[model samples]
Target: MEQTIQKRLPVGGDSWVTVDVYGEPDTPGLVVVPGVMSDAHTWRHVAGSVDAWPSVVVVNRRGRAPSGALTNSYSLRTEIEDLGVVLDEFDSARTLFGWSYGGLITLLAANERPIPQVIAYEPVMRPFGRHALPDLKVAEGTADWDRCVEIVNRQISGFSAAHVDGLRADPHSWATLRRLSGPLYAELSALNAEPPPDLMAQQAEQADLIIGQRNRGTAPYGTSFDHVRQHVVHAEVHELPGQGHLAHIQAPAELGHLLNNLAAI
Candidate 1:
């Protein structure tokens, strides 16, 4: 296994963001951006499996860091700005590999700033319809965080009851999900209030749209891909056979192989 190096880059204020780098220097860089409630650690297996072990940087987005305080607010624009900082900090010829919410962030960021290529895995872009951004809010400004997390897993991500139960039984996994609820809440609110971005207007010359075959039958995902197929220019679709939304976690080797193939192009 390759050694992973962690570095912190200042994102202004007193806040700093971390990136985990793997593989050799002076190689084409791959920036792995995780979905909501996720951090750099989630991509470790995938990064390690990349062919030839080209440089890979996995980012620890705000609020998902294992240590340090999170940013006070969340918004589409702010997230893009943070990504901009990461790009500058890494400073390499790069491709953006984004999963779910991170994919959505890449879509928007690529519009504002051009990147070499983007591979988006089931980006949570409500191109076809809105996600059920449930109002878990209370009068006193509290929320049923656990309930919201369950809703996201069940309704949005299409996890089964057994799957949810298994997650609950895993103390580390459950704790990470709970910790993500707040930022997830903020991100959902921002997405619901603002209109979805126009896919046709995206600046990237190449976009590899990846979807799990199992995900095609799931809610919003099926329709979301339909919209992407019709409109997104310079787009090519890749289906991960028998996988679902969590392909990166469930099949990291497969994901890594696919990424390595793209980088070889």
Candidate 2:
């Protein structure tokens, strides 16, 4: 294994963001985009699990404490540009793997600025049925970070009470979930209020859609794929057994296998 190095790139507004680079510079470029409440560290395992590990760039989106400060001008466009900057840092074909909210970002960014390829896991679509979107108003009204974290874990992620309790018991785990409540809320707000740009053609001809077999989040992914199928010439859907929405974190080895295989295409 090679030592991972940190790199920074300047986006608009004079704000600098960061990425953790791994593998050799000559290999194919793989950029990992994390979902809400996550940073570059969240993808550490997946990046490490890659076979012979290619050049991987794990990005820390805005509001992640390790990368940069959350600015007042935050929006989906800014986030898209942030990922684009990281891709520009590398000099090879950029293959993107995004999970959950990051999946949404990947699809949206590909539409605006087509990348070599994109693999999305459960991109956010208007939930399954009638469940309301995570209420930004509720998050705004509540000052208690713990409570806010609970709401998202349960209502949005569909985690059980026991899972929430276990998360709370671990100080590090609880802090990871609670630390970015503001950014998570902001992301939810954008999801509710805005729709991403539409795809014109098959921007990603060889895209892969990986989801968990038992994950309830699969429905939204299906909906998302249905909408984008016409614009995607070759989209294959695969499922990871015994995993859920956070499969990338829960089953890094298997997820990494799938991702690495996609990169080989």
Question: Which candidate wins on TM-score?
Answer: 1
TM-scores for all candidates: the values are 0.87, 0.87
**Candidate 2 residue lDDT tens string, 1-265:** 3436887777777677888888875677778888887778878888888763468878888778666765777777788888878777775746877887787778777776666788888766432222433454566567567877887777766678999999899998888878867576667666555544445214755577776777533445445545544444467777777776776678888888877777776
Candidate 1 TM-score versus the reference = 0.87
Worst 10 residues of 2 by lDDT: 125-134
Can you write out model 1's per-residue Cα lDDT over 26-127, one digit (the tens) per residue? 566888888776777877898889754368888788766653444565566667888889888776746888887788777777787777788888876653
Name the runs in model 2 displaced over 4 angstroms: 1-3, 126-142, 198-201, 216-233
The local distance difference test score of each candidate is 0.72, 0.71
Give the lDDT of residue 255 in candidate 1. Answer: 82
- What RMSD, rounded to one decimal, does every model reach? 2.7, 2.8
- List candidate 1 stretches off by more than 4 Å: 12-14, 67-73, 127-131, 138-144
